[model samples]
Target: MLTETRRVARIVLLDPDDRVLLLNGFEPRNPATTWWFTPGGGLEGEESREEAALRELAEETGITDVALGPVLWTRVCSFPFDGRRWDQDEWYFLARTTQTATDQRGLTELERRSVAGLRWWTSAELSATRETVYPTRLAELVRTLLDEGPPHVPLVLAPEIV
Candidate 1:
């Protein structure tokens, strides 16, 4: 089968303490190589990036009251998951909230099997930890955005490993 390129919208959910929430999951075929990523999934037909981001944030984390901010960054990533090669173009949005509780009832079957858990990470923790995170320079990007606010234009990020 031909590998299709998927368009995804993700959210960087920040708390009052400046920590960002991330979901931990692994490639189903290779569970040992786990990674953490922001909450998101592929966009549905005709849905705008922001709409997808909002839906995904609610579905993935069950936090729906936060105001979505502008696109902070974008990246193109290719990875293997569920026995398929996925080429995904992802847009990242910034959102802030004080809510800490999350409900995982909306997670898909794949997510339920592959996702290990979630955590809130400070910039320092993101920088110091060896665990893999997508967009590679998440700590630097988060610190910059927290310090200066969102940019006038969304920043382009480098591709990350599979």
Candidate 2:
């Protein structure tokens, strides 16, 4: 049977104040001022999703020793890459880090190249932020987590009429 080989796994990471971490950047291809996303990346060769999340956290934000959790959102991003529309299956997660990075740590090449900036935004602030890559549904989920506390409660989604 020919089937799509889609990757799957759990991803999660948190901030010092318990706020989720978000990344901001300008993809040369994308319009200017369109920046905002979580801190994470693809797994390295032979690396598990968990390992990749941990590694990406360090490489992108210099964050470490975090408590990882289940998948919050699995996004199928279809965008232009090298003049071709490439599909990216990204799995977002929920995690918590006891320690936070100080400004002294500074930005690394991965961060500088991939991310224009990083900021911790509360659920309320997220709505006001003119820029963010998070989907409205995902943002609402995050807001719920922040308001009610961790261990995201199950949310009932309204069924769409075909």
Error of 1 at 158 (Å): 1.6
Candidate 2 lDDT score relative to the true structure? 0.59
lDDT of 1 by residue, 126-162 (tens): 9898988877788889889888999999998988647
Name the regions of candidate 1 deviating beyond 4 angstroms. Answer: none
Looking at candidate 2, the ten consecutive residues that score lowest on lDDT are 153-162
lDDT of 2 by residue, 41-114 (tens): 65557888777776777766667777887665565554443334434456666788876662414455534544
Candidate 2: which pairs clash?
Answer: 11-93, 12-94, 12-95, 13-95, 14-95, 23-37
**What is the TM-score of each predicted model, taking all chains together?**
0.94, 0.71
Q: List per-prediction Cα lDDT, in the order shown.
A: 0.89, 0.59
Q: Pick the candidate with the highest TM-score.
A: 1
Clashing pairs in 1: none
